[model samples]
Target: MLNIALAQLNYTVGDFSANTTAIISHMRRAAAASADIAVFSELAICGYYPGDLLEDSSFLARCDAALDEIIRTSAELPELVTVVGTARRNNGPGKPLHNSLLAIRNGQIIAEYYKQLLPTYGIFDEYRHFEPGPQTACTLSVREHRVGFMICEDGWNQPGLDYKVNPFDALKQATPELVISINASPSDIGKRKKRHSTISKACQETQLPILFVNQTGGQDQLVFDGASFAVTPDQGVVFEASQFEEDFQCIGFDAGAFMKDGLPLLASALVDLPVEEFTRRQILLGLRDYARRCGFSKVVVGSSGGIDSALTLALAAQALGAENVIAITMPSVWSSEGSVSDSVDLCKNLGIRLHTHPVADLVKQFSTGFEHSFDTPLRGLPLENLQARIRGTILMEYSNSFGALLLTTGNKSEISVGYCTLYGDTNGGLGLIGDLYKTEVYALSRHINQQAGRELIPEPIISKPPSAELAPDQKDTDSLPPYEVQDEILKWHLEGDRMPPAEAKAARNHVQGLQTSEEGRQLVARILAMVARNEYKRRQAPPLIRVRSRAFGSGRQMPLAAKY
Candidate 1:
C-alpha cells in the first residue's frame, strides 16, 4: 500500500519566504500523517504565472535559496519524499532556465523532471520564458513502487495546439505503475469537465493509477481553481479534493488488487447544479483568494444603485462576510430617488453596512471655483465626469483610512467600449467583474436572486433599463449600442479576433432583432476603436481576476501606441 498526500496551496507572486514556509508546514503535516510521499502543484515554490519576474536573476537566486532550505529541512523526515515545482538554471549557455519538478528524499535531491512542453499562445507565454525539456520521463521508487512524474502542460496532447506532448506516452516506455502530474491550470467555463475527461482517459489507457495536483488561488490576473484528485488503475477516482480551497488529503493505493482486468469507476459524477450557483462559487473563490493572498481582510465598493455595483457587493459580502463589506453610495443631483431606494434595500437585504454621502455639494463647491474661467455650461461631459470623480475620491479615502481594498464594479461590455470614466469609476484596488460582460452581469444577478429564493436585487433594478445616470435621463443606449449587440461584437472582435467590419456585418445579419444598418456598423467600428485606444488605461488599472479564456491582462497584450 502506498499513501500519498496532495498539497493544493495558494501562492502570491514575489513572496518567497511566505511560500517556502507554507510548503514546509504542509510537508511536516503530511509526514505526521504517515504519508510516504507528498506532491505540490506546479510552480509551488515561486508563484505560477510569474510573468516578467523570471527575468530577474536576484529573484531566481532567492527562489534557489528557498529550495535549499526545503532540502535541508526534509532530512528530518527520512520516510517521506516531497515533490514540488521550481525554476532551475539550465547550466547550458547564456541564462537558460527550465521549469522543473524536484524530488527530495532524506534531505537530498533525488530526481528532477523538466517540463517537456511550453505553451506560447493565449494566456501562456512559457515558450518566451523557459526552454522546453527533452522528451523524457523520470521514474523513482516510492514505497517500493516505480512512480513516473510529469508537469502541467505535458499531459495535454491535443494536436494543432502548441505544446502537444503527452506525458502518458513517455510513461508507457518506463511502464511505471503510478504517475503524478503537477499543474497550475487556470479556471475557465467548463474547464473542469474537460480536465476530468482527459485524466480518466489516461488512466484507462495506461492502466496506471494517477494523482493530479493543481494550485489554488488568484495570482494577478490568473485564477487557479484547485480541484485535485486521484484516479485508480481501473479509472475510478479514489479521492477528490474540494475546489477553490487550500487542502491536503491522503489516499492509499493497493498495488496488488489492480493488475487484473478491472475498471476504475469515477468517485461520483459532477453535481448538476444551476449555472448561477457555479458562477457564484467561482466569483466568491476568486474574490476570497485574491484578498487573502494579498493580506486583505475587508473590501469597500462605491455603490451607485446600479446592477454592476449591486452584483459586486453581493459577491464581496459572500466572500469576506457582510461585516467585512462596506458600501458607500455617492449620490448627485442627477441621481434619482429610485436609485437611492434600490441601493438602500439591496444593502439591507445583504446585511452589509451602508453609508450615504451626497456629492451635490462637493460637485458645486469644486465647479464654483472654475465657473468664472469657463464660459460654457458645466452640464456636459465635464460635469458628468466630476460626479464620478467625487465618488472615486470618497471611496478611496474610506479605503485608505480603514485599510480596506476598494473593488471596482465595471463590467466588460462597458469597459470594452470605453464607457467607464478613467480614474473615476475605475479607481479601485481590483476590478471584481472586469471580465464579465454586461449581459453576463444581468444573468448572474438573476441567478443570485433565484438562489436566495427572494429578490436580493430589487425588481426595479432588474426590470428597469440600464443607465449610467451620469447626466439627467442618461441611458446606456443613448451613447452606446445595446448590451446584447455590443457583447456580440466584443466576443467576435476581442475573443475571436475576427475582422471587425466583416464580422460585425455578419453578426448583425445573423443576430435576431439586430439592425444591419450602416449606423450599426459605424457603432461597432467606434466601439472597437475605443477598445484599442484604451489599452493605456487598462495597463494602469488594478490587477483584475480573470474568469474568461482571454482576459484584458496578460493574455491579450496590445501596444500602448498602435495605429491598427
Candidate 2:
C-alpha cells in the first residue's frame, strides 16, 4: 500500500521564504500521516509563471537553495519521499532553464524530470523561459510501487491533440503502476468539468491510476481553483480537494485501487458550481489575494449606485471584512437622487462605511479650465466624460489618502464598446468585475441577494435602469444596445471559440440570428467596430479578476493600431 499526501497550497510569486516554509510545513504534516509520498503543485518552489523573473540569476539561485532546503528536510523524514516543482539550469537548451521536478528521499535527489510540454498558449508563456524536456518518461520505485511523473501539460495530449509528442505514450512504455501530474491550472467557467473529462479520458486510455495536484491562489488576474483529484481506470474521479481554498489530505493506494480508511474509494461525482456562484467565489478570492499581496487592508470603490458598482462594493466588503471596504459616492449634477440613496442603502446592507463626495464643483472647475485653455467649450461627449474623470480622480484621492486600493467597476459590456472614459471611471489598482458582462453583473448581484436571504445589494439598485449619470436623462441604452443584446455580441465577438461549449453555441446562434436582418447586421458591425476602436482603452485599464476562459488581458491579445 502506498499512501500519497496531496498538498494544495497557495504561494506568492518570488517569495521563496514563505513558499519554502509552506512546503516544509506540509511535508511535516505528510510525515505525521505516515504517507509514502507527498506531492506539491507545479512551480511550488517559487510560485507558478514568474514571467520575466526567471531571467534573474538571483531568483534562480534562490530557487535552487529552496530545493536544497526541501531535500535537507527530507533527510529528517527518511522514510517519506517529497516531490516538488522548481526551475533548473539547462546546459544544452534553447531557453536558459527547464521546468523541472525533483523527488527527494533521505537528503538525496532520487529522480528528476523536466517538463516535456512547454505551453505557450493563452495565459501560459512557459516556452519564453524554459525549453521543453526530452520526450522521455521519468519513473521511480516508491515502497515497491512504480510511479511515473508528468508536469501540467504533459498528460493533456490524450489523442487527436495538436502536440507533436504525446508524453503519455512515453509513460505507457515506461509501464509504471501509477501516474502523477503536477499542475498550476487556472480556473474559469466550466474549467473544472473540462479538467475532469480530459484527465479521465487519459486515465482510461492508459489504464493507469493518476493523481492530479493543483495549486490555489490569486496570481494577478488568474485564480487557480485547487480541485486536485485522483482518478482510477475503473472509477474516473475518486477524490477531490477543496475548491477556491488551500487543502491537504492523504489517500491510500493499494492493489492499483485508491482506498480511504482501508476501504475501496467510491467514484465521486464532480458537482459543478453554478455559473453565478462560481464567478462570485472566483472574484472574492481574487480580490482578497490581490489586496493581501499588494499590502492593502482596505479597498475603496466609487459606488455609482448602478449594478456594476453596487456589485463591486458588495463583493469587496465580503472579501475584505466590512470594516476594510469603503464606498465613495461621487454624485454630480446629472446624478439622480436614487443613485446616492441606493448607494447609501447598499452600504448599510453590507455594513460598510459610505462617503458621499459630490463632483459637480470639480466638474465645473475642470470644464472652465478646459474651455479657457482650448478655446472650445467642454460639452457634449467631452463634458459627459469630464464627470466620469472627476469621479475617478476623487476615488483615487480616497485611495491615496486612506491607503486603500481603488476598485474599478466597469463591466465587460461597457469596456468592450469604450462606453467608459479612459482616465475617469477606469482608474483603480484592481478591477473586481471588469471581466463580467453587464448582464452577468445583475445575475451575480441577484445570486448574492439570494445567498444572503435578504436585499444585500438593495432592490432599487438591482431594478434601476443602467446609466453612467454623466448627462441629464442619460441611460446606457442611449449610446449602446441593451445589456442582453450587447453581451451576446461581445461574447460572440470577443470570446467566440474560447467560451464554454454551451455559451459559445448560444452566442453563435444569437449572432447568426441577428445577422439575418439588415438592421441587426448594422448593429453587429457597429459593435465590432466599437470593440476594435476601444482596444487602446482596454490596453490601458488595470488588471481585473479573470472569471472566463477569454479575459481581456494576456488571454486575448489584439493589436491596437491594426484594422481589419
Candidate 3:
C-alpha cells in the first residue's frame, strides 16, 4: 500500500529560495500525513515559463542548487520519495537545456525522465530553450507498485493534433499500475472542461489509472488553476483538488484502488465548474496576484457611474478588500444626476470611499485652448474625447499623489472598435474588465447583484441605458450598434471559432443574419473597418487581465499598419 500526495503550489519565476522553501515545506507536510510519496507540478523548482531566463547560465545554476537542496532534504525522509520538476543542462542535445523530472529517495537520485514534447505554440515557446527529451517511457517502483511518469505536453499527444508520439501510449507499454503526470496548464474559459474530457478519454484509451497534478498561480497574462485530479480507467475522475488556489492532499493507493479516508471513492463525482463561476474565480485570482506582485495595496478607478467602471470596482473590491479600492466619480456637463448619485450609492454599498472630481470646467478650458491654438473650433468627436482625457488626467493625479494603481474600466465591446480614447480613459496601470464584453458586463453585473443578494452596485447603474456621457443626451447606440449586436459581431471577428462552441456557433449565426441584406452587411463592414483602424490604439492600451481564450494583448497579435 502506498499513499501519494499531490502538492498544488504557487511559485514565482526566478525566485529559487521561495520555491525551494515552498517545496520543502510541502514535503514536510506530506511526511506528517504519513504519505509514502509526494508529487509536485511541472517546473516547481524554478516556476513555469521562465522564458529566456532559462538561457542564462546563472539562472540554471541556481536551479541546480535548489534541486540539490531538495535532494539533501529527501535524505531525512528515508521512508518517502520526492518527485519534482526542474530544468537540466542538455550536454548531448540540440538545445542547451531539457525539461526533466527527478525521483529522489534516501538522498539518492533513483530515476530521471525528460519531457518528450516541447510545445511551441501560442503563449508557449519551450522549443527555444529546451530540446525534446528521449521518446521512451519512464517507470519507477514504489512500495512494490510500478508507477509511470510524463510531463505537461507529453501526455497531451493522445489528441494527435500536433505531435507524433503519444507519451501515454509509450508509458502504457510498461504496464505500470498507476501513472503520474505533472502540468502547468493555464486556465481559460473552457480549458478545465477540455482537460477533463481529453484526459478522461486518454485514461479510457490506455486503461491506466492516472494522477494528474497542476500548478496554481497568476503569472502575468496567465493564470494556472490547480485542479489536480485522479482518474481510473473504469471510473474516469474520482477526485479533484481546489480550483484557483493552492492545495495539498493525500490519497492512498492500495491493491489497485484509490482511498478517500481509508477506502476507495467513486470516480463518478468529477464535474467542471460553471462558466460564470469559472470566469469569476479566474479574474479574482488574476487581479489579486497582479496587485500583490506589482506592489500595490490600493487601487483607484475613475468611476463614471457606468456599468464598466461599476463592474471593475466591484471586482477590485472583492479581490483586494473594500478598504483597498477607491472610487473617483468624474462627472462632466453631459453627465446625468444619477451618474454621480448612483456612484455614491454604489460606493456606500461596497463600503469603499467615493471621491467626486467633476471635469466639465477642465473640458471647457481644453476646448478653448484647442480653438485658440489650432485656429478652429474643437467640436465633434475631438471635444467628446477631451472630456475623457481630462478625467483621465485627474485620475492620474490621484494615482501619482497617493501611489494607488489606476484601473481602466473599458469593456470588450468598446475596445473592439475605436470607441475608447487613448491616454484618456485608457490611462490605467492595469485593466480588470477589458476582456469581458459589454453584454457580459451586464450579465456579470446582474450575477454580482445576485451573488450579493442586494444592490452592491446600485440597480440604476446596471439598468441604465449605456452611455459615454460625453455629449448631451448621448447613448452608446447613437454611434455604434447595440451591444447585443456589436458583441456578437466582435466575437465573430476577434475570436471566430476559438470561443466556446455554443457562443461561436451563435456568433457565426448572428453574423450570417447580419449579412443577409446590404444594410446589415454594410454595418458589419463598417464595424470591421473600425476594428482594423483602431489597432494602433489597442497597441498602446495598458495590460488588461486576460479572462478569455483570445484576449487583445498576447492571445491575438495583429499587424498595426496592415491593410484590411
lDDT of each: 0.82, 0.92, 0.88
Question: How much is the lDDT of residue 102 in candidate 3?
Answer: 88
lDDT over C-alpha atoms for residue 176 of model 1: 83
Tens digit of per-residue lDDT, candidate 3, span 2-99: 89989999988888999999999998899899888899989999999898899788998999999999999999987788989999888894998889
Instruction: Identify the runs in model 1 with alpha carbons over 4 angstroms from their true place.
Output: 164-169, 201-209, 231-239, 254-267, 497-527
Cα lDDT for residue 145, candidate 2: 96
Residue clash pairs of candidate 3: 238-267
For residues 8-120, write the lDDT of model 2, one tens digit per residue.
Answer: 99999999999999999999999999999999999999998799999998998898898889989999999999999999889994889999988999999999999998888
Worst 10 residues of 3 by lDDT: 267-276
Give every collision pair in model 2: none
Q: Could you arrange the candidates by TM-score from highest to lowest?
A: 2, 3, 1
Clashing pairs in model 1, backbone N/Cα/C closer than 3 A: 234-264, 236-264, 236-265
TM-score against truth, every candidate = 0.89, 0.99, 0.96
Give the residue spans of candidate 3 off by over 4 A: none
* Each model's backbone clash number: 3, 0, 1
| lDDT, candidate 1, 303-357, per-residue tens | 8888999999999998899999999998898898988888999999999899999
Q: Please say which candidate is ahead in lDDT: 1 or 3.
A: 3
